[model samples]
Target: MTHTPLLKPVWLSMTLLLVWLLSACQRETDLVEPTTNTTVSNTAENETINKWILENMRDYYYWNDKIPASPDLTLAPSDFFDSLLYTYSATAAPDGDRFSWIEENADDLSASLSGESTTTGLEFMLYLRSQGSTDVIAQVLYVLPNSPAARAGFKRGDIISKVNGQPITTTNYASLLYSGATNYSFGLAEVQNSALVDTDKTLSVTATVFQANPVFLDSIYTAGTKTVGYLVYNQFVPAPNNSSGTEYDDQVDAIFSNFKARGVNELILDLRYNPGGYTSSSANLASLIGKNISTSSVYFREEWNSTLTPYIKQEYGDEFFVQRFLNKSQNIGGNLQRVFVLTTDGTASSSELIINGLRPYMTVTTIGTTTYGKNVGSITIVDDSGKIKWGMQPIVFKSFNSQGQSDYSAGFAPSIEVQEPLVLKPLGDITEPLLNEALYQITGNRLARRAVATGHSLPALGSSIQRKAGGGRMIKSLTAFKTAKLPQ
Candidate 1:
C-alpha cells in the first residue's frame, strides 16, 4: 500500500504518458473505420473530374457558350483539339453520362470521320489560279489523264462553265464539281452560245477519257549533246471504280514500264503539283526507280495511354494515310537505292510517303521547297450508337526510315531546292522551274556529249525510246530552271 502511493512529480509524468497513449489509440480507431459516406464522396469527386473532361470536348466548338467538354479524357483529345481550326474542331459525347461513354471509346471517335470540317466553304473543291492569259487558267488540278474530259480536248487551262444540266454558277459550282458526274468522265463544260432566247447557256460535252499508255515518248530535250526526257504526271489518285480508268496506280505502273522500256539517257517525271495519291502506288513507283529498298519496321504509328479511361492505340496503314496516320510498323525489303523526286508544298500525304520510303535506298534529290508537314492522321468508325465518329485521334506513330532517322515533320529538304519561276504566263499555266532543271541535268547536246566523253553511255535507257544524236526543237515555254528562286 505504501509503495502504491506515488510522488506528485511521478503522478504527473505517468498521467501525461497515459494521455499520449490514449491519443495514439484514438488515431488508430479512426483509421480503421472510415465513414462510408466520406469514401463515397471521394469517389464522386473523381467521377466529377472525368465528367468535366468529356464535357469540354463535346462543347469546344459551340458558338454562344463554350460547350462543357468532358474532363476525364486522356492527353489525346486535348492535343487533337489544339491541332484543328475553329471550323473543324469537334467535341461529341453520348447524351447520357458523357464521361464514361468517351472514356470507353474517345480515342477511336476522334479519328475515323473524314472531312471533319471546311473553313471557307461547305465542301472540298479545287481552287484554281488565273494565270493571266485569257486562254490559260491557273491553279487547276488535273483530275484525270486521257479521260473523256482531257481527251474531249479540255486542255489544262480550259475554264469549265457548267456540268451536266447545270450552270457553273458560284452558288452551285463548288458543290457540283466536288460531286462530279461520272457521266462527264473526263470532259469539261463551257458556256455555250449566248442566245436572246436563252439567258444562261452552258453545255456538257464529252472529253477524251481513254486508255493511254504510259510512255516517255520522244519528248526529251538535247542542249549541247545530252538527251533529256520530260514527262508529266498530273495526278496519282486511283479511281473509286475502274479497271484502270481513274486509278493513279495503273498510271504509275504504265509509267514505270515505259521508263524501263524507253532506254532513257536521263529522265524527268514532272510531278510539280501532283497532289499525291495512293500509298502503295507511290511506294511502287519509288521501288521501281529505287535501287536498294528497305521495308519499315514501323510507319507513322501512335500509342495512347492505356490506363486512362478506355484508351486505344492507333494503327496507321495504307488506308489511313488519307486520314491522319497513327502508329505504323514496317517490314524489311530486298532493295535499297536512290530516288529523284520533283515536289512542292502541294506535294502531300501519299506523295510524301514516296519520298520517305525511297530515302533509304536511293540518292533522294528533292527539287522543290519544303513540303506540307501533316504527319498525324486519324481513322473513322461508327460507334455502338451507329453514329459515324472519327475516333482514334490518330497520332504520328513512327517515321522510321531505312537510315533509322525519322524527320518526317521536317519533310525531305531539296538537295537542289528551287522555286516557282516568276514567268509571264496566263492565269492557268503553271510555272515549273524544277522540272526544267532536272531536264537540264539529263539533257543538252553538250551534256550528252560530256557524259559520253566522261565515259558514260548516253543512257541506253533500255527501251527504244532513246533520243537520237540530236533531239527535237526546243519548246518555248517558261519551264526554265535558271529563272526560279529558292526558299529560305
Candidate 2:
C-alpha cells in the first residue's frame, strides 16, 4: 500500500530506515570481529596475573608444599587461588588451615592493616536477654574517637534495644548492626530493676572513614602504695602511614611516660576487646612493658614454609628468623615483675603475641575467658603490575614466643576465668566485672559488685553475636611485600 501511494515524504523515510538498518548491522559486525591484538593482549594479561599469584603462593604460603602441583588456571583468579589451599580432611581438626585469604583491593587492605576504615566508630557486644533467648540486646563496648557513633553521643554501656525501629532479635541483629549501612537509627535501652527496659531516646549515626587510635583507654590507678598502669590496648596497629616511624610508638611512649612519671609500678594490659594488628607494633608495646628485657633477646620467631625456609635462612641469617625487642628511646623500662593481661575471646593475634612474647620476660597473668588462639601471622602480597588491584593475605609463618611456645591453637585458657556480665559498665570502671577482678587480683580488695542479671556466659555471646560479626580475631602481619620482589 505504501509503495502504491508513492508519496515523496514516505519514499524518503523508507530510504532513511534502510540506511539505518544497514548501519546497525555494520556496527554489530564490527563488534563481533574484534582485533586479534586485543584478544591476545587480554589472554596474555590474565596469564601473567595467574602466574604471579602461583609464584607468590609457592614462595610465601605457610603450606607451600600442600598447594596443588597443577592448579586449574582457566578458573577465575579468586577460585583458582582458593583451589590451591591445603584441603582439610574430615578427620582433621576444624581449623586445620583456614586463615589464608585474598582481597580484591590491595589499597584497602593496606589501610585496614594500619587500623583505618569506614566505621560508625562503635564497638559493641551483642548479648541475648538471657541464655537461649532470641531477644538480643547490644551493650556498647567502646567508641572510637571522631566516629559517627561518638558524634551521635553514643557512650560505652549505652544499651541498644532496637535498630531501625525494629526490636533487635537474634535473627535480624547482625544484619541491622554490621550490614555496612551508611546510616543507622539506634533505639536506646537501659537495665532497670535487673531487666532491660526500652527508652524514649533514639540516635541516628552515619558511618565515616576514620583512623582508629589503638590506645582505647589508659589510666593510672592507685590502690594503697601500688600504682598500676591500666591500658585498654585494642590493636597493635601503628599510627596511620607512620608504621615505620614512632608515630604510634610515641603515643604508647606518652602513655607509658605518664605512667612512669606517676611511678606506676604494676601494669595491667586490657586486651579484652582487642583483635590483633601490626606485629612490629606488638613488639614495640611488649618492649615498652618489658623494658628490662634485653633488646638483643628474641621476642618472637617466625617459621616459614619448608620450601622457603632454607633460602630465607641463607639470605637473612639466623637473626632474621626471630624478631628482637627494640631498644627505643621511649621504652619506659619500668621493669615490672608481673603484668596482668585482661583477655576475652576477642583478644587475639598481636594481642596474644604481646602476652606470649613477653611471657619469657615477665609474669603474664591472663584474666577473663580464653584468649583467641592464633599463633600464625600473615604478610600482605600485592600484584607487581599496576594493572591488577588484587591483594593476598596468605599465612606466611607460625610465630613462636621466646620460649618456643606457639601451642595455643585451642586458645589460651584464662588463669582466672571470668565472663563478661550481661549488665555492662564503662571501660576503666573499677565496678566492671573484668576490671573489678583485675583490681581485686592486684589490690586484694573486692570492690562492691554492680548487680548483674544472672545466667550470662561468654559462650552464649560467642555463639550468638561473634558468629555474626565474622567471628574471631583476624590478625594481619605488619609486613608487606610486592609480587615482583618477594624476599628469598
TM per candidate comes to: 0.44, 0.82
Which regions of candidate 1 are displaced past 4 Å?
1-138, 141-143, 146-153, 158-251, 265-267, 294-338, 380-398, 408-413, 421-432, 444-488
Residues 279-310, candidate 1, lDDT per residue (tens digit)?
33444455455543234322222221222112
| Runs off by more than 4 Å, candidate 2 | 1-48, 87-90, 93-95, 241-244, 329-335, 446-455, 458-488
lDDT, residue 269, model 1: 52
Candidate 2, 404: how far from true, in Å?
Answer: 1.4
- Number of clashes recorded per candidate: 102, 0
Q: What lDDT is reached at residue 100 by model 2?
A: 56
In the order shown, what is each candidate's alpha-carbon RMSD? Answer: 24.2, 15.8
Measured on C-alpha atoms, candidate 2 has an lDDT of 0.67
